[model samples]
Target chain A: MPKQERAEETRRRILEAAQETFASQGYQATSVAEICQRAGVTKGAFFYHFPTKHALFLALLEDWLSQLDQYLNPDRYLGNNVAQSLYAMADLLKAGLTQGRDYLPMFLEFWLQAARDPVVWQATIEPYRRYRAFFANLYLQGMNEGSLCTADPSLAAVAMVSLALGLLLQGLMDHESVNWEEAAPAAFRWVLSLMAPDPATTP
Target chain B: MPKQERAEETRRRILEAAQETFASQGYQATSVAEICQRAGVTKGAFFYHFPTKHALFLALLEDWLSQLDQYLNPDRYLGNNVAQSLYAMADLLKAGLTQGRDYLPMFLEFWLQAARDPVVWQATIEPYRRYRAFFANLYLQGMNEGSLCTADPSLAAVAMVSLALGLLLQGLMDHESVNWEEAAPAAFRWVLSLMAPDPATTP
Candidate 1:
C-alpha cells in the first residue's frame, strides 16, 4: 500500500483498538500503551493521529453523532407520510440500539466525560443541539403535512428526545429486566398516537 | 449533647460534606482526605463512619433514594383520581428538580459510578427495580380505580419512568436550553392525558 493508504489504515486500527480497549477495560482504566500494542502501531503513530486519549474520545463522539445523523436523515424518510416517516426513524433507532449494545458502556463513559470535562462538554452540546433541532424540524414537517397533531414543535421534539434518552439509560441500567427492543417501539408508537391527527375527522 | 447524639451529628456532617465535595469535584477526583477536610473531621473519624469512599457513596445513594421515596409516596396523593395523582407526582418531581438543581452533577456521577462499578451497580439496580415496581403498581391501581385507560400497566409504567429519566438527563446536559421546570410538568400532563379514561364517554 502507498504511504497515504497506510496512514489511513493505521488511524482506523488505532480507533478500533481504542474502542475494544475502552469497551472491555473502560476509559479511565485503558492506557495508550495498551491501545498501541493492540493496534500494532508505534506510539509515534498514535500521537501523530491523535494528540491525547481525550482527543481520540472526541473523535469517537463525532463518528457516533455522524452515524446517528445518517440513520435519522429526514430526507431518507421524507417521501413517506409523516406517521410512516416517524415510525421509520423509530425503527432505525431500535436497530442502532441492538447494533450498539456492546458500545453502550463506552457511550455512558462519554456522557460522564461530557458532564465532568469542559472540553468534552463543548464537543457534546453542539451535536446534542443539532439532534434536538432535527427532531423539532421533523415535528414541524409532520404538523404541516396534517398527519400530526398541532403542538409546539420544539416541545414535542424535547419530549421525543427525552423518551429516547430515558429508554437508553434504563436499558443500560437494567438490560435484563426490560425487553428494550419491544419497549422502545411501543413507546414510540404511543408518542406517534399522541401526535397523529384525530382519525374521526379524517373521513 | 449525649454521646450517641454527638456521633450521629458527626455522621450527618460527613455526609453533607461529601455531598458538597462530590457535587463540586465529582466522584473519581474527590478523595477521602478532601471529604474529611470538608467535614472538618479527622481521617480516623471518617473511617469510623464509613469503611471506604465507595461505602460513603453508597450511603449517599441510599439517602437520596429514601428522600425520593418520601417525596413520591403514593399515599400523599391518594383518594384523588388517578390522573390527579399523576399530576400531583409531576408537581412533586418539578419541585425536586428545582430543589436538587445544585446536586444534579452529583446524581450523574452516582449514575456513572453505578455503570462502572459492580458494588455500585448492585446498590443502584435494587432501588431502580423498586421504583419501577412502585410505578407499575400505581398504574395497576389507576386502572382498577377506573380513572385510567385500558392498557398494559407494566408497559405504561416503563414509558412514564423513561420520560422522567429522559427529562432528568436532558436537564443535566442542557439546563439552559430547556425549562425543565415547565417541560417536565407538560410532559407528565401529556402522559396523563394518554392514560386517563375517555372524557367523552365518562358520563
Candidate 2:
C-alpha cells in the first residue's frame, strides 16, 4: 500500500483497538501499550497517529458526537409528521443499541469519567444539551405544524430524553429485565397519544 | 457511652464517613484507611464492626434500600386515591434526591461497579426488579380501583423508571440541564392525567 493509505489504515486500526479495550476494561484501566498490542502496531506508530491516550479519547468522543449529529439534522424527518419522525428516531437508536449491546458498558465508563474530570465532563455534556435542544425543537415544530397538542415543549423533551436514558441504563444493568426494544417505541406512542389534540381516546 | 451504644455509634460514624468519601472520590479511589481517618476510628475498630471494606459497602447498600422500601409500601398510600398515591411516591423520591444531591455521585459509582462485577451486579439488580414490580402493581391496582385509564401496567412502570433514571443521570452530569424537582412531579401528574377517566382536559 502507498504511504498515505497505510497511514490511514494504521489510524483506523488504532481507533478500533482503543474502542474495544475501553469498552471492556474501561478508560481508566486501558493503556496505550494494551491498545498498541491489540492493534498489532508499534508504540511509535501509535504515538505518531495519536500523541497521547487522552488525545485518542477525544477523537473517539468526537466520532461519537458526529455520528449522533444526524439526530439534530431534521431536514429529512421534518417532512414527516412529528409523531412519525419520533418513531423513526426511536427505531434508529434501538437498532443501533441492539447491534452494540456490549458497547453500552462504554457509556457507563464515560458517564463515570465525566463525573470526575471537569474537562471531560464539559466535552461530554455539551453534546448532551444539544440533543436536549434538538428534541425540544422538534416538539415545538410539531406543535406549530398541528401535529401535536399543547404542552411545554422543553418539558416534553425532558421526558423523552429521560425515557431513553432510563431505559438504556436499566437495560445495561440487567439485560433480561428492560425490554427497551419494545419499550422505546411503545413509550413514544404513549407520549404521542397524550399529545393528541382530541382527548376522547382515554377510556 | 455504654458499650453497645458506643459500638452502634462507631458503626454509624463509619457509615457516614464512607458515604461522604465515596461521593467525593468515587468507590475505586476511596480507601479503607481514608474512611477510618474520616470516621476518627482505628482500622482495628473498623474491622471489628465490618470485616472488610466490601462488607462496609454492603451495609451501606442495605441501609439505602431499607429507606427506599417505603416506595413499595402501599398501606401509607392505600387510603388515598391512585393519583394521590402516585404523587406521594414522586414527591418522596424528589425530596430524597434534592437533599442528597451530593450522594447522587455514589449512585454512579455503584452503577459502574455493577457493570463490572457480577456479584455486585446481582445485589444491585435484584432490588431494581422489585421496584419495577412495585410500580407495575400500582398501575394495575389503579386501573382496577377506577382511578386510572387503560394501558399496559408493565410498560407504564418501565416509563416511570426510565423517566426517573434519565432525569437523575442528566442532573448529576450537567447540574443545570434537568429541572427534576419540577419535572418529576409534572411527569407523574401528566401520566396520571392520561389515566384519568375524563377525556376533556387535553385541549
Candidate 3:
C-alpha cells in the first residue's frame, strides 16, 4: 500500500480500538493511554491522528452513524413498495446486529454521552434530526401513494422509529433477553399493517 | 403521625434522595454520604433505615415497580370492555408521566444500573417479568372477548409493551421533542386499530 493509504488505515484502526476500549470500560473510565496500547500505536502517533480523547470519541460516533445511515438508506430498500421497504429496513438492522455485537456497546455508550455531555449532544442532534426527518418523509411518501392510511403520517413514523429503538435497546442491554431477529420481522409487519390501506370501502 | 407511618415516610424520603443523587451523579459516583446529605438524614439514620447503598437502591426499585403496577392495574381499568381497558391503561400512564417528571430520571437511572450491574439486574428482572405477564393477560382478555384480532395474543402484547417503553424512552430523552401526550394517544389508537377485528369478516 502507498504511504498515505497506510496512514489512513492506521487511523481507522486506532478509532476502532478506541471504540472497543470505550465500550468495555465506558468513556469516563477509559483513557488515552489504554486506547493507544490497544491500537498498538505510540502515544505520539495517537496524538498526531487525534488531538483529544473526546475528539477520538466523536470520530467513532461519526463512523457509527455513517454506517447506520448506509444501512437505512432509502435506495437500498425502495425497490419494492414502501411496506416492503420497511420490512427490508428491519431485516438490514437485524443482519448487522447479528454480526456486530461490539456495535451495540458503542450505541449504548453514545446514548450515555448524549444524556450527559453537551458537546456530544450537539454533535449528535443533527444526525438524530435527520433520522427522524427521513422516517417522516418515508411515511409521507407512503401516504401520498395511497399505500398507507391517511392518519397523521409524522406521528406514525415517530412511533415506528421509537419501537425500533426500544427493541434495539432491549436486545443490547440483555444480549440473550429477546430473539430480536424474529421479533424484528413481526414489528415491521405490525408497522406495515398500520400503513396498509383500508379494505372496507372496496366494492 | 403514628410511629410506623413516620418511619415509613422517612424511608421514602431517603429512597427518593438516593434516587435523585444516583440519577444525577450515577450509582458508582454517588456515595452514601451524598445520599444522606441530600435526604437531610444522618449517616446513622441512613444505616438504620437501610444497611447499605445497594439495599437502598433495591428498595427504590421495588417502590418503582409497585407504582407502575398500580398505575396499570387491570382492576383500575377492568370495569369496561377490553378496548376501553386498553385505552384506560394508556391514559393512566399519560397522567402519571405528566405528574412524575421528578421520578422519571430515577427510572432511567434504574435502567442504566440494571444494564451495568448484576445486583441491580436481579432486583429489576422480577418486576419486568410481572409487567410482561400483566400485558399478556390483558391481550388474552382482549382476544377472548373478540375485541382484538385473532393473532398470537402473547406476541402482540409483548410488542405493545415494547412500544410503550420505547415511546416512554423517547419522551424522556427528548423532553418534549415530540409532544408525547398528543402523539401517545394517536399511537395507542394505531396499535388498537391493528388489533381491531377485521370488519369485512366480523359482520
Worst 10 residues of 1 chain B by lDDT: B194-203
Across residues B91-112, which tens digit of lDDT does each residue of candidate 3 receive? 6546655756666556656655
TM-score of each: 0.89, 0.87, 0.85
How many Å off is the CA of A141 in candidate 2? 1.5
lDDT of 1 at A118: 86
Query: Candidate 1's C-alpha lDDT?
Result: 0.78
Cα miss at B91, model 3 (Å)? 2.1
Candidate structures ordered by TM-score, highest first? 1, 2, 3
Give candidate 1 regions above 4 Å deviation.
Answer: A20-34, A197-203, B23-26, B197-203
Q: If you assessed candidate 2 against the hidden native complex, which CAPRI class would it receive?
A: medium
Per-residue lDDT of candidate 2, residues A62-85 (tens digit): 777786676546665544577556
**Cα lDDT tens digits for candidate 1, B3-30:** 9998899999999999988776667678
DockQ category of candidate 3 = acceptable
Interface RMSD of each: 2.2, 1.9, 2.4
True contacts kept of 1: 0.58
Task: Provide the overall lDDT of each model, using Cα atoms, as 2-decimal numbers.
Answer: 0.78, 0.74, 0.71
Ranking by lDDT: 1, 2, 3
Q: What DockQ does candidate 2 have relative to the true complex?
A: 0.58
